[model samples]
Target chain A: MRTDLLRRVEDRLRSLLAAERDLWSGVHEGAVVPIDALAELIASGGKRIRPAFCVTGYLAAGGDPDDPGIVSAGAALEMLHLSALVHDDVLDDSGTRRGVPTVHTKYTQLHGSRGWQGESRRYGEGVALLVGDLALVYSGELMAEAPRSVVPEWNRLRSEVMIGQYMDVHAAAEFSVDPRTSRLIARIKSGRYTIHRPLVVGASAAGRGDLAPAFEEYGEAVGEAFQLRDDLLDAFGDSADTGKPTGLDFTQHKMTPLLGWAMQRDEHIQALITEPGHTPDEVRRRLLETGVPDDVERHIGGLVERGCKAIADAPVDEVWRTELADMARRVAYRTS
Target chain B: MRTDLLRRVEDRLRSLLAAERDLWSGVHEGAVVPIDALAELIASGGKRIRPAFCVTGYLAAGGDPDDPGIVSAGAALEMLHLSALVHDDVLDDSGTRRGVPTVHTKYTQLHGSRGWQGESRRYGEGVALLVGDLALVYSGELMAEAPRSVVPEWNRLRSEVMIGQYMDVHAAAEFSVDPRTSRLIARIKSGRYTIHRPLVVGASAAGRGDLAPAFEEYGEAVGEAFQLRDDLLDAFGDSADTGKPTGLDFTQHKMTPLLGWAMQRDEHIQALITEPGHTPDEVRRRLLETGVPDDVERHIGGLVERGCKAIADAPVDEVWRTELADMARRVAYRTS
Candidate 1:
């Protein structure tokens, strides 16, 4: 059921975009550019984690496969994430995403090479901004196809993520290190947006909102684990595997919960992050020396355990419960 | 009726932001920053053109005021316009909006002055990007409160505007002057999004989809006139009344329908816009010498007449018909 739903979501995304491309291509040749950007990003692919959780939650709650709302809902989640990625890449000046030149990077070069009218950076970033807006609008269009019950959660989820992202940017700029702030960012951006809300949105789609409490608990724990692992991957993971540059968090001086925890223990980490001319490798080697990586690893394990335990007695089908546990482990331990 | 509805829309917008601010401030002090930006923009107002058109559309269609959905739809249109304005300011690099420093300008200074960790430009632009995103999300939230029947038109209106803006940006970059492309962009961005779709959404909220045809015709004609006046305002109007720097279109090399028409008759205007070191005064003087501004004034009068005539025989109440005619004149001929 999960695999089928995932396929359906994938199909919906491709065909919807293809249809948009077809329609806009006739309007003006340039109208298709942003739609094409969206299509390329989708094809380049990420983990599809949000959609997976959404569909899995729907199936685990025994939703009817024929309802069709879940498919659109899942697709909407992925599209929303795409918008965030496009805009976030601009914020981070991330040059590449999913192994492809990011929208801004590609367009910036296009403008620079062509000697376009305005500032090349502005033109490129502006194209990317509009493309992201298109994606956000498209996400809403898809979500409108879902059941009305999803509205409240969907609204809350989107606003929470944006606000959390604002705070994340603010924290990074300030080079802040507060566990309370970091935890709040993680809870809103990762715990809820990525994991908890998707699960509840799915279950609610299936008319089983009673599972929200358990889903929320499990989602928060496992989502934090997911985010910690993300920070680890950003710090030390292979660029080849991740398809994005490593140690961007360090370079951007992002106060990741992982980094915040490390900063609490090692004074030098702050200097390494905030001070220029210090390489990511310097920060990575320093991070290793701080012994905080091991602590993070241990915390991730505990969070995964707590997450699994949260759903242990839930009334989900036993098979699905076991699958959820496996999903937790995969999310926590996956390298990329 | 329109006045009361507009007031309700204004109240809805203020209370909604206040509530969001209250909720986010509890999470983190900095989290309320974006919400505050939105509130400030809304407070330092423009004409509230979109909301006025929306509520006017609903009232003209003989929709009942107590229904409440029209108010939210009106507010949604305004919120969506705010999102566009925020992003458009970034795209245009306009330092000021509504006679105050723009979000990017203000944040960029903060980042520069405080010596933020990342590039100040990136940090400032990023904050503005996220704040714009928050407005987009909030627009969706408000639209959700409206009747579901408004969704299709709402969706179409948003995608049209974004894509139209994309094409506009591309046209400016390419410095293209095709009349067809300019008119198409104008129709999509202004005719539909600014006037027609909001009205349709309003009427649809009241279950008056039947009024769409008249609204469409009136909107397209008046919207074009409205856009030409916008170009004129940018080229020649006072910033004190408009609350924004004039001649941004000239500097950005925007291929407005007004410019496209003028260029067809005059050969030298293109160089005036495309080349650097030419002041807005030069462009304005050159534009006047081309005798195009006079043609534009004549064209705007004709379009406004066309707009009012299109709805003259519609089923709308006689009083409302006169009000809408007055709105078209106000939109097309106002100093700002």
Candidate 2:
């Protein structure tokens, strides 16, 4: 069931994607350069985690494989996640993603090749923004096509994710940061959307009853663990493994695990953050130099372990436990 | 009848908004920075073109509001439209909207007061993105809740809008500027999504019989007129009247009615675009110094007149005719 589960999800996703392709039929035909490139980039190897989560959540809630609603909802979630990645890459000025040149980078190269100046950055970002919007619209459309009822979860999920994202950005802007605040930010930003809501949405769509509290508890714990794992990867992970630049979060002065730990133990970490004239890389290294301190690392390690354990021990069905166990282990030990 | 129509629509919108508000009940207290901001901004402003068109299309297709499925389907279109606006502001980097600070601008100001460096911009965009996402999800939820029969149209509408957005962005990235291409961009980017699909969705949702072709014809004509008017306004409209930054499209070298004309006529315009080195304003002034040629303006004026007339002449009900007539007149001569 476990091995077949991935195959099932991937097959459904492939078929859904073919249907979704019609959404951009004109542009894909018109401009062979950017539109086609973007489409290809989107369909390129994605973990499809959002879709998988949707599908998994549905199955865990006793949904049937033949249920077309699962396919639509899963596809919608995947589109939303992809859309966010497109926009986020532009915002972060990232040049590569998932081991390939990012959409902005490809467009920038195309613009340069065509000698289109001034609009290189603007065009890249603008096109990326539009692509993101398109994905967003399509996601909704796909979900709307689902056979099951989706109103209640769909309505609330939209608002919650947005609010959480806002909170994430706002918290990052703070010059003075603390652990409690950072945790709060993480919860809003990831906890509800990635784990909590997806599960609830899947369950609700499948007509499962009273699954909320279990999903909620598991989501919060595992969500925090997921974020904590991400922070570690950002600071210490191999770029080859993560497909992202190392030390990015630290360099950007993003308040994350390494900095949070350093700040708690030493005043010097504050000086490093407060001081001007340091490159993002320099700050990241400085924060790391204050050292994860065996005790601090241990603490973060404990939190992640505890969080994962809580998820594993939740009252969810055995499938959840099995699925979450793998995720937890990966989170705990993976370099990225 | 018109008064009642407006009141009923308004009341339905209020109820929808209320339902949406409740969706965020526990997680979103104290989140309404301007208590009536979204409601007022959406309610009192613009033509309720999307919703009305959707309803009209639904009715034309022999669908009925009295049919349990039509209401949510109609409302979903509105929610999707609302969500698009939230994200659009961020993409446009807009400040004021509907005679007030946009969502991003409002949030940015909130961060600025807190001494958050780069906080305002980041926070604003983040919040806006979140809000847009929320709208996207809610739109799906509404569709799912609606009577399941109209699902096909809802799905098609969703996909069409996204494709339209991608085309808009793709056209903006072009190095070679052509009037024809620009027109196509305008149609796909703004026309179909703004007018065509909304009308079709409305008629479809209402299950009106044999109205598809009429909606298409009416939507295409009106959509073109709407976009043409927008192009004229961008170039000639007073900032005070338009409530938008003057010459923004020109500065961005965006393909619009004004620039599209210039791009087609002059080699210098092509050179200016191809190798833009000077500031955007300098280029704008230089282009303007070539002056608004009577022939060029006349050409643009001709297109606008044709579009407006087409919309006015399209076969539809008396109520729609009057509305289209008023819109055409307003679009044809309005400064903004």
Candidate 3:
């Protein structure tokens, strides 16, 4: 029954995106080509995980399965998430996303083909940026037009997630970031946006605001566990399974959970990392040689075990526990 | 009275931005450096035209000056405009904005000083993007949290402005863009955002919805005039006064009104423009030599003269006519 509900939500989200894309039909003659290309690329490759969580959480809280309002709101969250990803790729100079050429890359290719000097990169970044802005605008419109009961929570979720994104970016750039600061960044950047806020939005839409706190706690634990698990995968998983380049964190200079843990390791491993210009591949290999992968994998194992225990221990309805268990089975245990 | 009202709006805007800036405190090692830097850069530079329009339109519609709700809504619009500008500069690869180094450039310089190659640009773009997102989020939050009476109109204005931005970006890229398409883009991108919607919000706040249509029409005409005048300045204005390198449009290949008009000029001018490898300066000089400048200047002169006549002929209120008159004086007779 829960699977059926998630499927329906996915369908609704696809429909909403399709409707919005149609609005760009009359965009200026030269601009429509790239805009349409980017939008289609985004729509084609989305995992729609955020929207699905929003919908499932709503349903788990007894939301009406047929509620068009809830569906539209959930879709808006998905679109916003997609917008964030599109802009992020441009900022990161990422060439590929979700096993496809990124919007910027595609647009850049067109620009190059047209023989317009320096235009390829400009077109890519410009169009992607505009599309992201469009997503944000539409997200608000969807929330505002939602059934009145759901508007308050939807707006709150949107604002909080944006604030959290700001905190995440700000925190990442600091050198001597404290543990508490890091944790706060973690909570706002990944914990709240990925789980807590989505859960609350869903619950509120379902008129189950009373369950919000419990869901928040559940989301926190699960979210932390998810990040930890992802950190482990970054080091240990096969390239195909992760669909990401191996040693990506080391290359990008990203300080993930595994790296943070390794930074706290006994002196030898720490010295190798502190070495300037050390390739991410070299760091990953060194960590592997030091038997650090096993240690980190054990840590991830512990986080998942603990996260599940906490979800199980929560004083919530059996329905929520069951749904969470299912989620853990799908998310924490899966290879992909 | 109008000047006093503008002062009130400006003060309110500063306070709101300050409060919003405070929200980032302690999130980044007890120093909100990046967010503060970006926000300060944005806050200090903008003209606050949107907020002025909101305030004046409200007053024209008999709005109460002391209503905190209108003030908040007006401030929110200004922030939204700021957010758009920050992102737009990044998108445009503009090095300086309002006579200051752009956020991306500042970050790049800082990164270079720190010997952080390439990372600084990424860091700057990432932080600036997040900052823009934050402003956008807060803009909605401000309106959403406004007293319920003005909420609907605020929502409408936000939607219109955002949709208009999308349309504007789309229109700017098109090749076969007709005059009507150009006019529509001007209306949505500049007219509605800069004037019409602000007026609607003001009128709605003042319980004078009847004035919205006139405001919309007036805004459309004036906004087109504004964009057309901008094109003229780009083509012919002094570099010192405009703060842009003269002939930048030809270099950037921007489809401006001057170039658009020149495209339809006699065969002599068309031949010069199609010359291969001509430097932007050479192109500008050649076009001017072909008497394109006289034609463009005459065209602009005609626009200003006709624009004033149209505004005078319209049945708008006295305040609106006075505002249009001021704009005409600025556009028609200003040396700058």
TM-score of each: 0.99, 0.82, 0.84
lDDT of each: 0.91, 0.62, 0.62
- Candidate 2: Cα lDDT at A110: 72
The candidate that wins on DockQ is 1
Model 1 segments beyond 4 Å from truth? none
Instruction: Choose 1 or 2, whichever is better by TM-score.
Output: 1
lDDT of 1 at B304: 97
State candidate 3's DockQ: 0.34
Model 3 lDDT tens row, A141-188:
566544566666665566556566545444444433244555565566
Please, what are the lDDT tens digits per residue for candidate 2 over residues B1-336? 333443455565577667656644444453442223456556646555666656555543445346545556556667777777776666566777667787878877887887774435655666666666666665676666565545666666665565555555555556456667677667665667766676665665554534566556656666666676676666656778876776566555567656767666655775665464755556566567666444445554665555445555554556665665565455445565
Stretches of model 3 off by over 4 angstroms after superposition: A1-17, A27-42, A60-67, A147-182, A206-210, A242-246, A266-281, A289-316, B1-5, B62-64, B146-187, B204-212, B238-247, B266-317, B324-336
lDDT of 2 at B191: 61
Note the B-chain TM-score for every model: 0.98, 0.78, 0.81
- Where does model 1 sit among the CAPRI classes? high
State residue B204's C-alpha deviation in candidate 3, in Å.
Answer: 4.3
